[model samples]
Target: MKAPPPNILFFLTDNQRNDLLGCAGNPIIKTPNIDRLAASGVRFENAFCTSPICAASRASYLTGTSEKRHRFTFLTSPLQSAYTDISYPATLKMAGYRTGLIGKFGIATNGIVPSLQDEDAVEKMFDVFDNYEHWTEEGYEIRQPDGSVRHLTDITGDKTINFLRTHQSDHPGQPFCLSVSFNAPHAQDNDPRCYIWPATEDHLYAETQIPEPFNAHPDFFRQLPKFLRETESRVRWQKRYATSEDYQRNMRGLYRMVSGVDRNIGRILGTMDQLSLSNNTVIIFASDHGMYYGDRGLSDCWQLNEQSIRIPLIILDPRADENNRGLIREELALNIDIAPTILELANLNVSDKMQGKSLVPLLEKKKVDWRKAFFCEHRFHRADIPKSEGVRTQRWKYIRYYEQQPVYEELYDLRNDPHESFNLAGDHRFSNHLKRLRRRCDKMSAECA
Candidate 1:
């Protein structure tokens, strides 16, 4: 008889940067569990989100399509059923995988959630869905039947462990897929605390000082284009990083929240070991998108800059050879590639409609021709957020704000200016390079559409 399909466990964190974890070479953060996971798996050094926002990026992860193809972003109408019906969870369920979702179901379907009453619609996607959002206004308290209050992060871990236990008890023979999406590390946005973590993590970085952000000086803020300087990113910067004290507190809080999530990941892995499931499970850890901790005088993610788009991506399959362990791949992996990767891991064929390619071959160390670069875009139209798209290659990044009166453009030589401190679009010497990138950007936008 053929061997049973491996169980899949996926963990997605909110607003986390690629360099925060110890495994990613950050010297200050406490993420031991995640670091251990990275040491045993393949970590993608250059993973990015096509759209650097929750709604669009999460939708891309689910549907294996770009935001341009899926057309789902904040304040937009609910995602079309055609796309939701083909979501990774839905497809895995159809293929005999018992799927479960815990924490923030960021996408809306047929209705915006917390107001969405259609239980049948959600049931079609996840067999066990515990959907929620960040506890911004009221704080992160969930009273249990025992009269004890628990943090939202702890409750999320409880639910995940409970899912593993219940699955083992109810469906011992069936392989499962569990998605644990954590709302930690994302700022409250409305709360003055900005970033909140469990009290347990209050002392993680109590004495260490956070380094000054890239281009954090007032001169950098003054030099920005008027449209960008007046945007919400700057508004949030005032709220979170207006002072050195504010910057230190908020950055430490974000790292503490990340450490809190790391603790829970340890709990989940422990549960897998206790249940004898460690040998047959594949685990993936990533974030929807990266956050800007006052990078370039920005607070939240909206622009296609490195700090806003780069995310942490790690995949560990227990069946892989020992040589593949601890390997770090400097490949250009996108959030959209996740669904296809999960499907391929379960021995299912990837759909033609899915724009992303499977990452299984990369994990196996197979000699496959991989993408050298990828398309990135942000189409959310708002006064504070501009509508723009771009093409990012190994050494260059070209962005265009098509909605601008004169269509403003930006070009960065990523090789020399990885921080993207200088704009090369106006430089006459790189005119040919600019023209080539512009045409490539247009062609990519068309292809994705």
Candidate 2:
């Protein structure tokens, strides 16, 4: 007999890198729940976000397209209605799945950034929507009857648990796709006390010393061009990493925030098991993009480097064979591939308009021809942030800032210099290699556009 469609529990985090969890080899962060999930599932070692910023990357994850195709960034208005129509949630709803979204739907729409009060816009996509932000300083949503405030991460877990309980009671036979987006570990840009965490997690990494970034030396910052040195990335770095004291305080806060989120994930997974849904639920955990801690003296994500673009992706299908459990895949995965994966898992056809390919074959261990390289772009043009595009292959990367005066380019051979410390673009010995990659970048950009 054919099995019923599996439920989906998609978890997303903001400003989290590919190596922040315990399973990813970070010794300090406490993420036992996520680590266990990775141990029982498939972890993609080379997952990346096409755009290394929040709004654009989140839109790409929802719409299954490149940021160049979606065109929703800081410079643009809300995401277009056409893209949302093909989104995974909307498509799953059309296929009779109960859909819910909790916490931090960061994509803007309808001429304004959405809040929890915006029901009309959210209803078209999610049947149950609860949207909020970091709320570390001013705004908050949940207050206990005892007059104590709940942290946003805790509130997110509560909402997800409520959805599962309600679904079991009301729609016992129907499957659900619940998306939980956590706004933890992302620095409150306006506040000087950046990277705030729940008070409950204050003791997580109190005494542990965070190792200094390998590229935190002044020489690395000196290697950057004047335009990049003057950008907002550097300004943000000054606020968080200007001194050793500030770096220690902020890094500990970041670690605690991540641990807080991990704690809530444990609660959510426990609820799924208690409700007898674990055997039929597929959980996908990932982040919108990555963060930088003094890497090249930068603190935020916008550049095309590994620290900014690489993100963690874990998929756990409980129905898969026991032998296939805990498998790791090395194929390159992108945020855009998420929508198509969800659609295929739900037994729907991937839209021709979607640029991402479904990862079902990879999950099933099928021999297939995969992409050798993928194109990445950032279009959030500002005085501090410049527009740029690039192509990243397995062994090489080429980035060009077309908007810069005289057009600056950067090339790195990833095989030898995995840290991307040396630029080979200007070397006469690699002129032919540079020319080849430049042409490839241009061709891929045009095709993606």
Mark the regions of model 1 whose C-alpha exceeds 4 Å error after superposition. Answer: 109-120, 135-137, 145-147
lDDT of 2 at 358: 90
Cα shift from native, residue 26, model 1 (Å): 0.2
Native-referenced Cα lDDT, model 2 = 0.87
Indicate the residue-level lDDT of 143 in model 2.
66
| Predicted candidate 1 versus true structure: per-residue lDDT over 1-449, tens digit per residue | 99999999999999999998999999999999999988989999999999998889999998899999988887776677767777788889989999999998788532227212233556777899898876544556566799987778887999999999999999998999999999888888778788879878977899979999998888988988899998899999999999999999999989999999999999999999999999999999999999789988889998989999999999999888898998888789999999999999999877787999888888865567889778999988688898889999989999998898999999999999999999999999999999999999989999999
For residue 49, give model 1's deviation from the true position in Å.
Answer: 0.5
Q: lDDT: which candidate is best?
A: 1
Cα distance off (Å), candidate 2, residue 243: 0.8
Error of 1 at 146 (Å): 4.6
* lDDT by residue for model 2 (290-365), tens: 9788888988989898999999999998988877777778898999999999999999987887999898777765
**Per-model tally of clashing residue pairs:** 0, 0
TM-score of model 1 vs. true structure: 0.97
lDDT of 1: 0.89
